[model samples]
Target: MNTVKIGWIGLGKMGIPMSQHLVKAGYPLNVYNRSKDKEDAFKAQGIGSAASPAELIQHTDVVFVMVSDDKAIDDIFTGENGLLKPEVSGRVIINMSTVSPAISKEMAAKCIAQGNHYLDAPVSGSVKQAEDAALVIMVGGDATAFEQVKPILEKLGKLAMLVGDTGAGNTAKLAINTLLGIVAQGLAETVTLARQNGIDAEALTTLLNNSALGSPLIKIKGEAIVNNNFNAAFALKYIAKDLRLAKDMGADTPLAQTAYKTYQDAEAALGEEDIIAVIKHLG
Candidate 1:
């Protein structure tokens, strides 16, 4: 077992499996979640749970956070009984949530002010990738802090790159999601066009997979479109949110602007469904 004890916060779709890798790696792991049932679920697995973020930090050296949005991130770090509630030092807090770069910078400053290190280490990939520990992690913060946690990060992601200092990971994630939105919109539009011309989705998807545009996303999302499986692996609303974040970051290209509006409009009814569900809106 590694000597550096580990703590985890926010056991959502991604967090649950990502933290499981650490426990499977034999690190003494502890966890906390706003909802008590998630903590109880871990407790059922014989892992310990903390009543609060501050309490969780009491027993662990490094903490990993993987929550939903900017507001959730803010509440986790600054709320009553939050991680920063107690004067803690020398601990590393790795935030893997997809939030704005501005919030990451704010939290990093707060953590550093109190003698702790913070890293904005958002990931690219959804539930399956997280479950398989094949996520691609983009990290930003102190290089030394990154190196200190690289081994641990490797257990959660296939690749972990230290991109830049504090909030760069969030920026890079937004940029990546911008392209992701465009691709999804492109794929949906192509399928819509093909169906309008009386082509089968499966046949079109097979040809596209065999063509120069072939990639894992195209294959998987194509299958989902063919089968009409709009399950929420990565929710549509999140891609909409990421596109909005990218727009706020000054992404105003023709495709960017169009894709943003397309996803945003689709989000009204399809927000809770899989991102590929945007295809349903087209039809």
Candidate 2:
């Protein structure tokens, strides 16, 4: 196979290792980051650097964006020095960012108008899973483009599923995050209550991991909370962002109203720390 020339935008906690994994696997990569310090790790990996989005667009056949939110994606694609404004062709932009479904749809249409393909390939996993290539990816948009990129995507994720048409990935990811918040709230609240009553948090986590109701999420995230590791496997800010997206989509689910309020309280208490920091609020 000809090495796929990839334009990797965003070099945060997840994006850094994801791009590094691709580089380690011998993919031709050109990386761009709004923050220079974050790019330092990749720079040591012999990845090419682009000072601007347009410069980055010049060097690749595909653009893999693992950014913050809709605004960050919009800025890269349609900002003053937007990638879309450059003279480019034969490109596919796979956004692994968990953005709003509405924004994903709009960006996909924009890519089509510019004669490029787009995929809303939002992911399920944190920075740790991302580094380990253990993420469950949720993708939506053109099937042909997805097929063409499946090899690369597989290298980055363990379970890459096609959910539906344009915007479906973001929609699914947001829905997942909403429920994840609720589950985290329940887990944290329960563990804190137990700990307060003299139950060992670690023992409870191990017990739950072996129980029918246990999941990989609770096992790993619960362990983090038990250890008081506030390292950003996933941040409260990102979860809060997804909760807001869920609230917009939850017109049919009034119960989601309650979860959103809980996330709001937790975020305020924790100052937008890691997902495990929600347990701090509970404690």
lDDT of 2 by residue, 1-283 (tens): 3488998998888898888778877889888999888777677867678898888888899999988988998999888787888857679999999999888888888888988889999888887788899889999998898899988898898988888899999988988888888888888888988888999899899889999979988888888877788877788878878888888876336557766776677777674577768877766
- lDDT against the true structure, per candidate, is 0.94, 0.84
Candidate 2 TM-score, C-alpha based? 0.94
Q: Which stretches of candidate 2 lie over 4 Å from their true place?
A: 251-255
lDDT of 1 by residue, 1-283 (tens): 7888999998889999999999999999999988888777789889999989989888899999998899988888999989999979999999999898999999999999999999999999999999999999999999999999999999999999999999999999999999999998899999999999999999999999999999999999999999999999999999999888889889999999998998999999999999999998888
TM-score between model 1 and native: 0.98
Which candidate gets the maximum TM-score versus the true structure?
A: 1
Query: What's the TM-score of each model vs. the native?
Result: 0.98, 0.94
